[model samples]
Target: MLLEDHQLQSIQWTELSRGISFGVDGGCLVEAVERLGLVDIVTVSIVPGGQIVLEAPLGNAAAYWHPCFDPGDSLPADWAGRERFSAVRSAPIGVLVDANGQSSFAFSFDCLTQEGEIEFGASEEAKTFVVRLAITDGLAAARSTVRLAVVAPELAHEQAVRELSVLLHDGIAGRQASEIAREPVYSSWYAYSQQISHDVIMRNASVASGIGCKSVFLDDGWQKFGDGRWYAGCGDWVPDTAKFPDLRGTVAELNAAGLQAVMWIAPFLIGEQSAAYSGLARYATHYSEHLRTWVLDPRHREVREHLVAVCTRLMRDYALDGLKIDFLNDVMNYAGTPSTGDVPDVGDAMTLVLSEIAQALESVRPGSLIEFRQPYISPAVAPFADVIRANDCPADADQNRRSTLNLRLLAISQVVHSDPIMWDPSAPVEAVSRQLLNVFFSVPQISMPLDVLPEAHRARAAELLTQWRALRDVLLGGELSVGLPNEGYPVVSSRLGSTLVVAAYQPRLLDLDLEGVSELVILNSTASSALPYTVFGDVPPVGSALAEGETAARVVEFAERGFVEVPAWGITRITLGA
Candidate 1:
């Protein structure tokens, strides 16, 4: 309903300089042509009907771009080249909104030919607002297209995202939902990092099972040591017999303890010392001087086969339930020549390789869990993986919340996971609960050594986790509503059937409409001692509050449009009247 008001028109092309031309066809498709070198900026001016705002998901765990620019402001500046810009940090999908926070126009590119930036600013020369799509990394004699859409003003953000998701799913490989994607998983990166060993992993898995985690992701440190660098031991996909004397037994033990075993692997990276590095040198598309590793060229048939074989072996030999494919964004050649001899674009290559790996693993083990992180998170790659996790943002709950919400808005039906949550074990129970509560809507992957956590903290985690498990279905599958941007989602609400759940990050009073909603749960994610809330429909005046560190919910008073003094980082559940 929101996309019918605007019409695509006024198609025109302009030659900005030698060997370069830019134009729009049928009002929605923006095309750029380069004959010899890179074309940086192509500007298009339009008279926006309302307040102008742009929404772009960042490349990684950084902030989402939702800046509301005035008549004179410039778009946010770029961060140099792709190497410095972080991998695949910006998606082609963006929304243009009017003053009423309604979608006016939306845009998405089919593929990323090269690393680029699409920015918007007020153009004094044209006396109108202009959108500029810049290719920071020069493309050699190529053409690119950016698809656009005109939507109705009343279309909500979530609805617009749903439409975008459909477009992406149709364009790329679309993923089917899986149960393991929604289950709670434990990761070893935050707890052990490179210090992981067989015994430590089992101990962590044992505790994870005790606290209701269904899977354990054993992160870096399985292969032979290589110069003390975490990824230096990569590319070999072999279990270091020294640390893991009996890999099969370890997996069996974990499965026996009710925990599925997931291993982390970087398919693109080839350590210098790894034997595979010398044998696969011809397949190297990019070399990272920082990590001193070569990024395997996925476009090469042999390279794809190698990656597939690696994943296949992990699933077949070790009998792993899943694989956390890491560093997928590093497959591109940022420093050297962009493309050579009909090589596919980095984005396309990544999609193909990941698809093959996922297919190979699933063939051996049906419904095998596959995890991928940010930057590689696009509709094209979504179909190849079951779980898309927020990138690493250790101890930063706010970033994790933002990343999860951003991913949810884009992934739609897929399981959007939080960055493995790692916080100071010494923090108060209330503080620790805030970490879990921040990502309440998405599947959570805890990466802390539970056995070593303070008893109070462990108990708090168990209480919050239990409540989360009970509400997992509603929280993960419900219709989601994200409040105004830039305010860090002061209020995020999800609704399913007659149940309504709301989480408040800011201290502002939350005004909720509960028509036909029989049950309501509110989570206070702030540091304040209490959360203030009000319901619009006919509901009970009192509810039950579950304070942090407490196992029981105590009866609490809730007057219509009045504040309920919930504990800091706690929750309250209210029942409604018929």
Candidate 2:
């Protein structure tokens, strides 16, 4: 059912004749309405005496889904659900889907300020679902416009989410990504975490370059001595002479080994032990007990210039290919130092800092890569971010797969990457294989100590990386479809030209479209040996031609449907017999 303007206004506590100013705090002054068929576009001009809060009610919501909530989180057992949900400048959208995978109601808020809170609950008096949006900071003295949209209910949940991304992207000035941003990467985090040196990375880079990795991310521990302080040494961007005596020379060595070098930096963190902390502690906005670091206030002109200089200097001095900026979501408002800077809103200040850094880096080196991670995966940062990866799910293959898909569905135009895939050296071969196959839809990042891997594990890693390198164009750039997300997206497939690749996570009958297809590759991610498939068009019978990592092809001919008995956690390639 389409929600008309009158219906929306009627549900609100304030009565709107021309425009309502019913509250002493953040009250509306003017209202302009534009109709986009089924979707309603309502623009409100607010004069903020305090924080602004708006509530929208939906009567048909069955399940609520948002980017901040992981797909693996527990679902609602009854009418009780999460009491409060929040969105930062990083992630600012959510949707309500019915049981049939159709979006019942959706909201995308233009909270270009500090942070916004969304509360979801059942209204007992009204018997409806309520979504409340509150913008707590960054209100301008001039007219601050809030664009609230309720999307069409007819769209599939995926389509609805994609449209929301497009809506958000239309408001930002973003840049294009470089060619190398989509390549396979080898990171030094899980393998050696905080205990790396020049020799260790070069050894792994050589092995990674030989096995099809195009880039290496030098994670933490490259910049400070090993005093066991987590982030107390983060603010200073200088490399520790003890760990990497020749930073410039080490970068050259990586480039000589056919790999691009990307350095990691927490640009907003001011470690308590660093000299900058002593001078700039007054500019800090919050303190994090977990990392033992203070969040630098980006609103200050000095603070912004310092971070921009720090990032761009690395690009110029080291001739670096890119930077992996971390912990941007930690830059929100938290009542730290008073706001005494040129930029009024912290959200706008954060945006300005990232934009200036990207602009400056481009002057130093054109097509320099910048990466952001999961909860920070919004089109707002797409102007500077070339890659958006899953959050750190080190050894869990399923979490990597699910997180990448969630990011891909929302940030449709951005290049999505899996978290660095890591595993124990003595893990089973099937477990290692699942790690590679699960991240096929997105760019894969391996964080293993390749030089010291078990012989069998190293061989398998090399073989799968080689295979992924060959099919990356199809896997990353093809038309993709996902099965029921409520069921944890058990089946995902992609097609480019005539090549089709489908990954099945659960043992179920695969219903596929086979019009004008020359090749089919089934990635069995589960332990089921029999993969059952039924083709949907006028297609000829097919034969199993190649079974990877297995001795021979074992097939069973069931006249009713095609079934290939693949090894547990293996890949099978089939050719159509015309």
Candidate 3:
């Protein structure tokens, strides 16, 4: 059993105990990805002793089976009596060996790992591969790094957050950040260039003084989305020279407002149409004949140094506090160059890229925030990450709620987590809006066009945030108890310190009976419903089951443990003071 820990350095993996050496450098996998629930790293070296048993932690039982996809193998004429698992899609998983300038290797996984040949090459080491795996029952799980160092951190604050989360699980309320030293925890805004104006950023900061907008984020669009395309042209990392000429001035305004400035930086790109693509072309890995976008060759030292320099310049130029790394995943999916290139772990090249990004970013700003949006990457890579973006898009509250719940399920395994229930600037607040409200009890994020919100709604939002911050300690440091209750309705409840926050919804009283709830709050994550419940344990200060005394439920004896109902989709807070 050969095991390796990928840090910020590369350690050549040679089978010494077994006594086998392939010259000085015997091809080794450097990184891996922990996507879905399957771990994809090179446990088995290509030379020999490469087969490693893919297993989970003790006590957590799981099943494994590989199903391939075919256009027309066989299909039942009817929908009934069909296996749900029968219809699925898959790809190949193999090792890449750089022969001179070209690269290729082969590996396999079948109903059983027998008689499977894998081969892919020429691939300069630029793209990152997605070694898909189905994981079950774990929060914040990290995939194994094959035989190299350089692991990526989701954000700069991950270390502090994960450490604090562990302490929080033990009922301690302590938080650390680069700035605050230690107070008020933290929150970040998703700053979208197309939507957020200086005014919006200021207002969001002002509004957040109450709820929890610790830091303000500036998402993509500073440049252009696609051509001057999709958000991929990260190589041209300066504030889209056209968007905001005075980047320093704009960010300065946020800094003065006491809001930390965080910027969106893909930091790497290769479009022939792009300014640097022609020059970067010499170092890119050729994956497609179309040649629309080229993979960046991190294996090339110049590319690495240029990325570091560019990032440093951006930070210095904008006086920004943090950065959101968009696509380190390019490592695995990319093709590597010859000589100076290192291969990604078995099937996780993204891990290596992420790790490299973390080191480079930290060298510039030790506590830089590195937000990665994929959830599966959260666990296998959270220790190096600050904030994990649960999903790419925040469609609605219910969807967000499911996202939040699924993410929570990952939390027991992930020591660090971000609040879901997001509000993307362009996302309409129709369906899942209520779900976001309910999700506040879990990890919360408000990614909406909050600054330009109607005055009345803004005021209401402001008021709610103020209350949320008051209980920040309780929210971040409480014990979370959850229930699927047969999937009829989804409910997640957290008992933080003296307060208990619960988000519940269902059709015609979904039948939820909390066991040890001291404080009760109803969240409207679904369609509007008439809530029929009251506070169970300690009496609340302001809003309680009695506020709507007549319309809502108010059971005197069992307010503390019985079931309750809400008529609409939204969130209500109930506090319990000792």
Clashes in each model (backbone N, CA, C under 3 Å)?
A: 8, 1, 96
lDDT per model, in order?
A: 0.65, 0.72, 0.41
Worst 10 residues of 2 by lDDT: 15-24
lDDT per residue as tens, model 2, 225-326:
434646877787888888899999999999999999999888899987787778788888588888777889888999999999999999898899999988
**Model 3 misplaced regions, further than 4 Å:** 1-212, 224-233, 286-292, 335-353, 375-380, 411-435, 441-443, 485-489, 507-517, 524-555, 559-567, 570-578
- lDDT by residue for model 1 over 1-578, one digit each (tens)? 01111121232435343222234432323333322121123222222121112222221111123311111221232321111121244355655444333444444444343454454433333322334443332322233333333222336655665666566466555566555778888888888887787899887777788877888888888767622664555678887888888888999999999988888888888877787888887778567877777888776778888899989998999998888888776666642355442444655556667778878988998888888888666665677887888877899887788778878877755688888888887777766788899998899889888878888887777778898988888888889887654455668889999888888888877777777776778888887766666767565445555554567767765467767666667776766541
Best by lDDT: 2
Candidate 3: residue 508 lDDT (0-100): 34
Q: Tell me the lDDT of candidate 1.
A: 0.65
> Model 3, range 340-405, lDDT digits (tens) per residue?
444422123333444566676667767766555543332334444555454544444444444444
TM-score of 2: 0.87
Winning candidate number (TM-score) = 2
2 versus 3: better TM-score goes to? 2
Candidate 3 has its poorest 10 consecutive residues by lDDT at 80-89
